[model samples]
Target: MTDIETRIEQIAQVIGQFDDAQVPRNIRTSSKEAVEQWLLNKNKEMDLRLGMTASIMDEIFNDSNLPIHFGPMCLQVQTVLETLLNEVRGS
Candidate 1:
């Protein structure tokens, strides 16, 4: 895989952490959908995919039902995604 694809995979792995049963159903489902629909959707441009995924991560972070600990984790993933997006755009 290319560096960008590898970074996206890493972000998806981080998002996967929210898939546990302990997380709210909607949050878990949304996280999964973000990875499947945004991050892994190869049909989209890499920068567009990263931007969309970051947007979804931001929404997931803002969700009231999200666990407190997950907020920072989501932010971290979003930050990484945004950074990757910027790099992709720069190239």
Candidate 2:
């Protein structure tokens, strides 16, 4: 598989580890907001090819009422996204 596809699969694996009751409500909201903000900032620097990826991420992060169990997965996804963003920024 391609690198992006591989990363997306890895993220799905991480997300599959949790259930809806494991995360706290507050954490879910915070994580979503954090990811949304990060994506917004990164969107400015992303190439056209990555725009669809960013839009998908934005859709995921835009949900303010995601299950509490999703918090950890969100953080993991955030880490992966941050790494990707940093790469895009050449940091």
Q: How many clashing pairs per prediction, in order?
A: 0, 1
lDDT of each: 0.89, 0.49
Candidate 2, residue 80: the lDDT equals: 73
Return the clash pairs for model 2, or none.
Answer: 23-68
| Residue-level lDDT tens digits of model 1 in 9-40 | 88889899999877999999989999999899
> Candidate 2: which stretches are off by over 4 Å?
1-5, 15-55
User: lDDT by residue for model 2 over 47-69, one digit each (tens)?
Assistant: 33234434444455556665555
Reference-based lDDT, residue 77, model 2: 69
How many clashes in candidate 2? 1
